[model samples]
Target: MSSSTSSSEPTAAWARFLRLLLLFAAVPAAIAYAFIALVDPWGMLPLSLPLRRETVTTNQRFSYPMIAQDPRFDSVVVGTSTSRLLRPAQLDELFGARFANLSMNSGTAWEQAQLLALFTRRHPAPRVVMVGLDKEWCESGPLRRLTPRPFPEWMYGGNPWRGYGEILNPFAAEEAGKQALAMLRLARPRYGRDGYADFLPNDARYDAARAAQSLVPPPAAPAAADPAFEFPQHALLAERLAALPAVTRAVLFFVPYHVSLQPRPGTLDEQRMEACRAAITRIAKARPGTALADFMIPSPITREDTHYWDPQHYRIGIAERLARGLAAAAEGHPSAEGDYVLLVPPVGH
Candidate 1:
């Protein structure tokens, strides 16, 4: 009876061990199937479907095409959407230099520096890199952290998977398979263009004209003026400017803002603006080949409600005038002075 009992105990132990093995094996297989079914073929699973407003378009259908197609650009524009008004074609015509606009919406100084590094790696360091300075870019935060995924360097350069493992986890063999699938076009490229260009009045006016509607609206009320805003991010801006290769000529321009929408008196906004201007002034004085151009003057054209897409983006005519002003400021630099004047608009329009 004792022998029979011992034999039964051994059989029971074997059964339990087999059950545990099957459980472990089955769990992974189930997860794998689910991942295969739900994850996009690119090894990227949408954090949220129906892409949000902030998603950086990763596919080559839009701005990637612009970068890939233009390999000979001798100049590049780096800024947020505020600088997007300055078109590459316009700058190329004015400066006689091949150019590309590397501007993105809400792009932080860190991202801009990274892009500059990327550009220097591939192309000849641009002869002139016009950086647009706006008040909001000084705000603290990783500008793209709230989006579905961190901004991928692949959006600007090739190698989508370059820094993937560092930014994401759950690195698995299945993910490798998925990436292979994406390469073969079996999976959709996991990004779409948010209408960054849509904010420009040029496209708005075109759409309005096509729809047989007038684009102009009535004049807007005067914007409250804030004279006290202090900008702390200018230090970061200075660091970035200093790090640029000696071959690159950098120009920082404070883009115009509609006076009608200016901040109120004694507000933090005014203080911040003052700090930024002061910081930029100091930077220009210290840097050998750097210059500043301030174009934030209120004019009849700029004060009109229709002149801007919102409070910051200007119409095509205004953008053209500003670009020409920038060209003039850049050209006016003397060969020996190592200093350039900041050009402000003439009084009263």
Candidate 2:
């Protein structure tokens, strides 16, 4: 009987230990879940916590879609950091339609494609779409994903259930807390209403030497029968744009990159860019009401370093000019010389 009692004593002790362990684990988890449910960062839960009117502070990959799908916006500007300076309000006024700038920093072509697809697939198709084409979209690797930091697919995907798990993440929780504080007026919004964030100072100075250094010719490559230009991703972009109905005006404009970003006038890189441009031109021709505004061509804006904050990014003023020029081109009006060439399809195509 004594031996049996001792054995049972150990069993009871183990049972108590298990209960304590479960409580310890369950309590914190319950608290965390409760917190996440309350926060509901990605709007996955039923709790509609008044998240601040976030513009720039939020991860654009996650936030842009939410705003784009709001149905209030009928026009959208999609591109990389080069396109972020564009104000949605400006586009709205220019085109006389509600607009949202869905550009992200280093936003990959695949990512942009996904966002565009998501936007167009909605019940009411978008009225206008402006794609800010750049090297990333024109270069190879259609299947290639975003690098350095992968785009969060769960947040962008149609499944709301998966988003609950996303908000439970530590990083997302931190963002939720920031949003909560901002909503409560404890913090300020990180960006303005139009999703324009000025990362560079307005008074940024240009150094001639620095610009010269950036212009150093790249090492020569072995001569080929034709310049090695691979742009399968651009084809995908064309396909998506073509899928849009004739009512939608799709504008594909090459960002006016600084001379440094562009290849030397007659080099192999120039050849590659030309090939990409030709391919895009073909796509534009195939689709009715689609226009290709070739700002990638030689231009005063592309030549002047003073007009740019960096070799790749132009100033906000340039963005304004580009916006005005695009608006003018869309209306069949003349714009500033040497800025862009507006290519429209032949009449009655």
Best model number under TM-score:
2
- Candidate 2 residue lDDT tens string, 50-156: 56345324567766656656566788888988888887788888888888787878888888888887778662467788899998877754457676764778656
C-alpha TM-scores of all predictions? 0.59, 0.89
Off by over 4 Å in 2: 44-47, 50-58, 204-223, 333-336, 345-349
Q: Which lDDT tens digits does candidate 1 get at residues 1-349?
A: 9999999998999999999999999998766655443442332333312221222233212233335224567777777778876867778888778776766666666566556555555664667778887755545333432223256554445554443332233443345344445555676433322112434434544442333223233243343454433444556567766766676666777777666545444555555555666667777666666667765544554455555556667677777777777777676542132122374321111
- The true-versus-predicted C-alpha distance at residue 223 of model 1, in Å, is 17
- What Cα-based lDDT does every candidate model obtain? 0.56, 0.72
The candidate scoring highest on lDDT is 2
Scored by lDDT, model 1 comes in at 0.56
Per-residue lDDT, model 1, residue 293, is: 74
lDDT of 2 at 136: 80
